[model samples]
Structure formats: C-alpha cells, structure tokens
Target chain A: MTTKDIGPKNPVEQGVTQVVDFVDERSGVKNSGRWLMFRNIPAGTSWFQTLGFTAMALFGMQAITGIILAMYYKPDPNTAFGSIAHITNEVTWGWMVRGMHKWGASVMIVIVFLHMGRVFIWGAYKYPRELTWVTGAMLLLMTMFMGLTGYLLVWDQKAYWATVVAVNIFASAPILGPYIGDILRAGPEFGPDTLSRFYSIHMLLIPGGIATFIGLHLYFIIRLGISEPPWAKRALRVQRDEEDARRKAARNREAGLKGSVSFPPAWVDDEQEVKR
Target chain B: MKKADKVAYDKDYAAAKKDGKPFFPYAIYKDTIIAGLAILVVIVLAITVRVEMGEPVNPASTDFLPRPDWYFYFAFELLKIFANQNALTPVIMATFMVPNILIILLVIWPFIDRGPERRIWKRPFAMGTAVLVISGLCYLTFLGASTPEGIAKGETLPLTGLDAAASAGEAVYLANGCSSCHMIKGVGAPGPGPELTNEGAKGWDNAKMVQWMKVPVAPMPSFASLPPEDLENLSTFLNGLGTKYK
Candidate 1:
C-alpha cells in the first residue's frame, strides 16, 4: 500500500479502478465518464499537451486581465477617457495590467485563429470533430465581439467615431442590419446607454457564452483526443520501434544495459507498443 | 463487426477508468473557489466605479461651430470644394461617383480576391489595394481638415452711398426677411442666405444684386416681396458690411 511499492505499476489499470470506484460511490450515470457508457478503449494518453492547452492558457490570461481592467473602467463617455488616463498614470501597475489586457485581447484573437488553423490543416474538422470546430468558430466570433465591445468602453473621440462608422457599416447589411444596429446601439443614438449596454455584454453576457462554449469544447477535445498529423500513419510504425528501443534502453540503463529481458517479455513490450 | 465491437468496448472501458477520478486532486473545491473569487471581484469593481456625465447637448447654437467628427471631415471638406463652380473641373468625379465606385469595389473585394492564402506577404494585391485606398482617404481627409471657413475668391458687389444706405439697409434687412437667408457676423436664422459681410465688395454690380434679390436662383431663395427701395437698401447694407475685406 506504500507509495514506493506501487511505483511504476500499471497506471492505466489503477486509473480505471479508481473511476469504477468513483462511479460506485456516486451512483449516477450523469457523473460517469463516457468510457463507462461506451466501454473498451485504451487510456493514459497525454492528449491535452497541444495547441488546445495553449488556447486555454491564453483564455486564463484574458480572464485575469479583464477582471483587473473592470476594476477601474467606467463606461460613461465623459469620464471614460479621464478614467483610462488615471489608470495609466495614477494606479499602481495599472498601466502594465491594462497594456497586457489590451495586447492580450489581440493575442487571444491571434492564438485562437492559429489554434483553429492547426485544426483545419490537420483535417480534425472532417468527421466527429466537426462540432468541436463549430464551437471553436463560435468562440472566435465571441472573442472578436468582446474585443469590439471593450474598445467602445474607452469612449474617446476615436472610439466614438470609429463605432459610428462601424455601426453605419452594420446598417448597410440589408433590412435587418438597421434593426440590429439600432438594438446594438440600444436606441436611436450612440450615447451613454449604448456604452452601458456594450459594457454589460463585454463583461457578463459574452463571457457567459464563451464559458459555455469552452466547457463543450473541452469535453469534445478530451473525448476525441488530439488528432494525429497526417505523418502519424508512417510515424506510428517507427514510433513503436522507437518505443521498444527506448524501453530496452531504459531497462538496460536501470540494470546497466548488460542486463537482458527474456524474449517473451520483450515480445509483450513490442505488442503493447503496436497496440498504442 | 464483432471484432470492431470488442475493440471499441475495450477502448471505452479503458477510457472510463482513465477518466473516473477528478483530473486534479482538488478539482471541485479549486474550481468553485476560483469562480467565486472572480465573480466577487467583478461585482465589487462594478459597484465601486464612478461614472460622470458631461454637459447636455444643444444643436441650435452658432458659436459651437458645427464640424463633422474628424473621420468624416474629409468628406465634409470634399462636399464644400465640389460645391464650387469652376473650369477644368469634374465635381461629380470627386464627390459622388468616385466615392460610390470605391465603396462598390470594397463591397465586392472578398469575392474578387478569394485566394485561400491569408498571409499579408502572399496577398500583395489585397494589401496594396487597402494601403492605396487608405492613403488616398487620409490625404483627402487631411486636405478637408485644413480648409478654412470663409468666402470664395474673385467675388464682389458694388455699394453706392453706403453711409446713409447702411442704416436704411439694416432696417430693410430685418423687415424683408434678409436675416432669414443670410448670416451677419455669425448670428442669424439657419437658411441658404448668403453671408452679408463684405458682400458688395465682391465685384457684383447694383443691377445684378437687384436682379438676384428680385428672383433667387439655384441655392438662393427669392426676395420678390421686397420693393425696389427695400432691395436697394438691403443690397446697400450687404455691400457696406464687407468693406473691411475689400
């Protein structure tokens, strides 16, 4: 039962036992892992160590910095500019935090785009992963909207007129464009109310949407695992041989490569590699 | 089918075991704590922030100087320039038609350049077009911003006997709705009325002034209600007002 005694044991077997125990304790199908529902799959693959993790890290940064910004930000036009100036000049480390948040917004956009691009290039969106790609696209659109709304909260002359032109562009979108534009503005004009509405959406509603999507996205990602690149077909064969050599080398290094495993045990190791 | 089913079933069993426990040691506790702290911070900050409102807007003031927002100043200036009449000029080319064409070009750009490559270097044509259009807009906007407000060049009107004429003409200006059409020293009703300051100094003769006043043309409204004497006096007042410019 001691930790050292269990060291290097079948982690996969241990993990499966633990999941079964948890399911027994919880007594609900809802809490059960999909593996229980479907059964019979290989496990213990480090699938999360990829572009998805990078995107998650970026999202974590955005959440932290966005909170810091919401502390001092005022959505009203008159004081918004002054409040931003004060944040830059007066507040401790406010400039750095704001700069990170501003740049982080742009970085998040770029990172999500790259993440999506990688998925596309790998053809991960081709089959069962189509929903994952769709969710990701929704996240991208939401992030852009978050950026746009956040920009308007600054409420300077530049922000004001840029939004004016942007709203006019929206108004150009056939019949519903004008209606959508009006609803977005929250009235006939871009005034304090528009800023308030945008601030609320930026801070609350859009983040709520993104949070839901992220949950679903993470579920799909974990369920599907990372898609192997096209070269993986050829690499898989080479990788098994490499794993055998690595395992043999590891065993030898442990007992000074002069030591040798029986042929049957070596065969089992070879079979396990190919199974993966 | 049986072999595939067995493989899938085994895979699922292994997956279930792997996913059974929480991914991290303190998953529920840590996640809830973090979510609570974040929500608390947002609420506290939202409540504490003070937003101040500015003064109310008034649309009817002349002293305020109605200029379009900076982005549209270039267009505003363009409109003013094109409103002018001159030889060797195509006003519509600069004003309506060219801008309309550029907008059309922009609207159809995605279709025209549908190459899958998204890199800036690879998409030289798209990037170049963007740069050219933006630069041209910036240049026009700059020119628009720089144009000063005032009367046009090479325009003048004659004023005869204006010392007595101005006092009589001032009265006529008020009575005959002259102020409705024109701005005198920046205070008057908004209308197509010409600015009367140094008006007579702009090379326009008394007869032309009378004719123009009797029957307004194009942008100017007619003053057919005014008698000949009132017209003369009103013209005299206008002619006298801009003597300093002359």
Candidate 2:
C-alpha cells in the first residue's frame, strides 16, 4: 500500500530484503533462532573476543585524547614543552588524558603483540591469511614508529637526549647512515626544526598511512570471514550433508517420489546449513 | 549389495553434490556495524582533543649543564668513562656499533629462531638471550645514572704537600703533555681527552686521585715513576684547583 504498491517494491527495500533472505536462505539456522541470539551479542565469545574489544576501546580513548593534545601542542621546538606544561596545569583533566594516552600506547603495543601471538599459535597465518599476517607486522612497526616520533615531539630533556642517542645510533649505519640520521633530525643537529618535522610526521603522516593500511587490513579480514577450527569445519560439513538429505526427503515426502526435485533445490538447504 | 542399488546410490551422490550451497553468504550488516563504530570513534576523537605547547629553546647559556635526556644518560655517562684519548676511539666504536648490530640481529630473529615450537618454555635459548641482553642494558643504564661526573680526572691528580697545590697541579699538568691532548678552561686545543677544569669539584678525593694516577691503563700512561710526594703534590694541586679556578 505504501511504496510497495507503486512498484513491485522499492529497490532499496527489496535489496535489503534480498540480502536478509539470502543470508537466511543460505544459512539453515533461522534468524530468530536461539543460537543466533547468542552469536549476535558482543562478549559472547571467550577471552580473545574480550581482548579485541578492549583494544578497540583503548584505541578510541587514544584518538580522543590525542585530538585534545593536538589542539594545544606547538610543533615548534621553542614552545613545545611550555605548551605541554600549560595543558597539564591549566586544562581540566588534561593530565588524565595525557596519562591515559601514554599508558594506552603501552597497552596497545602489548595487545598487538598478544594478538599476533594468538594468530601465530592458531596457524591463522597459513595460506589465505598470509597477507593479513604481513599487514599486521607492518601495522606493528608503524605503531612503534608513531610512538617514537610522538616521543620526540614532546621536546623535553628526556625527548632531546633520547633523540640524540637514537640519531647517533642511526648514524652508525655503514653507508648512508649519517645522511639518514641528518634527515631524521631535519638538520645536522636536534633543534626546533627537528621537533617540528617529527611533530608533523607524528600527527599527520604516520596516522594517515596507518589508517589507510588498517582499511585494507580490515577489508581482507572481513573477506576471509572468521576462520573456523578444523574440528568445527568437519562438523559443519557433516551437518550440511545431513541437512541436504533431510530437505530432499521432505520434498519427496511432499510430492510423490516419482516427481523428484533436482539436487539444486536441496543444495539451497546445504548452503543454509553451512551458513548456520 | 545389488548392482542396481549401488548404481542408484552413486547417481544420488553425484546429484547431491550438485545441490550443495554456495561457499559464502551476504551477512554484511553485522561486520558493517562494527567497522562503522570503530571509524566513528576515531573520527570523533580526532576532532575534539587538543595538544599543548612548551617554551622556546635557547642555545647560548653556559649554565645549562647541557645534559642529554635520561634515556641517553648511559651513553653520555659512557662518554665520561672513556674521557682519555687512548680509550676514546674504542669506546666511541663500541657504544655506537654494538647496539646497532644487536638491533639488526633482533629484526632477523624470527627467521633465525625458526623452530616449530612457540612456547616460551620451549624456546630457552632465545628467551635466555633476550633476558640477558635486556638485563645487561638495564645494568649499564643504572650504572651510568649513579656514577658522578669528573670523578675520573680527579682520581689521577698528585697530592704532595704544596700550599699552592692548584697552581702546582697546573704546572705538573703542562709538564706532562696532558695539555697536548686535553683542554682546561677552554684554553687548550681540542684533542682526544675530556676537559679537566672541574675534575675535583665534581666528586674526587685525594686518595682516589693518587691511586688512579699511579697505575693508569690504555689511554692515560701510568705515572708510577713519579715520586709519591710529587704525586701527592699534584693531587693536592688538582683538588685545590677545583675551588680556585671556579
């Protein structure tokens, strides 16, 4: 009577229904089933799921806190530390945000490492998931670099000496090491210029790169779907075959056995079972 | 067991295979919601939070002490230890060279330690090495932090009886060729040794000074041939210089 009467149905609504129907039809498990209820909720899984959620939550906190920090932070070396002090002293809850950001970085590093370990232990990096593993490794490296660059932008005594030592280490490289070191410092020495360079790279460059890579990483993950345990895969296959047989039997029982429906009709049920 | 029944079973199996479902279903909604929330949180936070700034740096000040940050204190402290010309080259090489080599080794560790086992207990060698290296670094950093500056040079001065020990020590300093490779109060040419202007004031007693001077190694040649009295005079002079020069 509404949009449905003007045409067979609105294309958008039809598309949505088709998608739902497709999922429901493919997965033998009913949408309103008990198992569906459990699967739909977060925290339904074990420790891994909980940890994943926590990491995401922490990242959210960091992003918010980092934005607040960016508003007052001076990229120039001359005023960086003074600005930081002002934020800590004047801004309400600024200290808490800074502390949380700092601690959050440490937590994120640890969690990322744990996540990698989990994937390694489960052999999730095998075959189709190799790209995911490589991307994850890159992410870890980028995150560490982000932390390093961010540390330099603080322009405090601690940051200065740390950069000096770090630059000296870089200069230790065999060939173009000194050049690389100079490039990083934005000159031959650590100064305001170096701080500005690091600040830009930390705030703008690295985050942008990380966000892009994260997009690709997430795309691949969803494309692959959640990996099933070997036992679960076997169970799923067996269950699918049984459901196919049951659907075929029901069709035969409904129509005379003489006029048998094609296996494709039963194939839909198999798809549904697999989805379930 | 009958031939006709078996053929029928084979036919059914082939037909059943054709009827099986597609490999994937379109359940975009669930994952979409998760991704959307993650993006939203990042965007919202990025827009709201602010960064604070600090003071401008001034390079000309002499009183700044110019100490490197805490993390690099170990290296800065290391530079102090090999303050002598003879030890400078090796110390500089070791301080910069060794850590780089270790970092390279760490980057390739996964490939190097490619044993099938993943458990920490199973990977005894790698774990032990990591613990050992980390502990060594911590020890060095702690040692660097604790050791006071200028203790080395003060330990080498003579402590003979002399009223103008500071002036006498200056005389002894010039007589020894220490000035050729060292500087004092920004007067001497740049050489392989650290400056000796504030040696005694920084934390070196007479006893420690004479002992170091008597049996030097590597960079500083031993002055054991010098009479005990002259060495004592030199130590006294150096100790006195700490107060007189400043």
Question: Number of the top candidate by TM-score?
Answer: 2
TM-score of 2: 0.48
**Which CAPRI tier for candidate 2?**
incorrect
Number of clashes recorded per candidate: 26, 45
lDDT (C-alpha, whole model) for all candidates:
0.55, 0.55
- Across A151-207, the per-residue lDDT of candidate 2 in tens digits comes to 766665445544554566566566787797788878866655888888778878877
In model 1, the runs with Cα more than 4 Å from the true position are A1-49, A234-276, B1-246
lDDT of 1: 0.55
TM-score of candidate 1 against the unseen true structure: 0.44
Worst 10 residues of 1 chain A by lDDT: A40-49
Model 1, position B237, has a per-residue lDDT of 65
Q: What is candidate 1's lDDT per residue for B1-246, written digit by digit as tens?
A: 234333433353344445444444323344445444443443444335433332222211111222334445555445444433346543443444565576566334434654333334545776677667656767877875665433323322343345776668666665443443345665443222335654656767667777887654322324555678877876766655666322
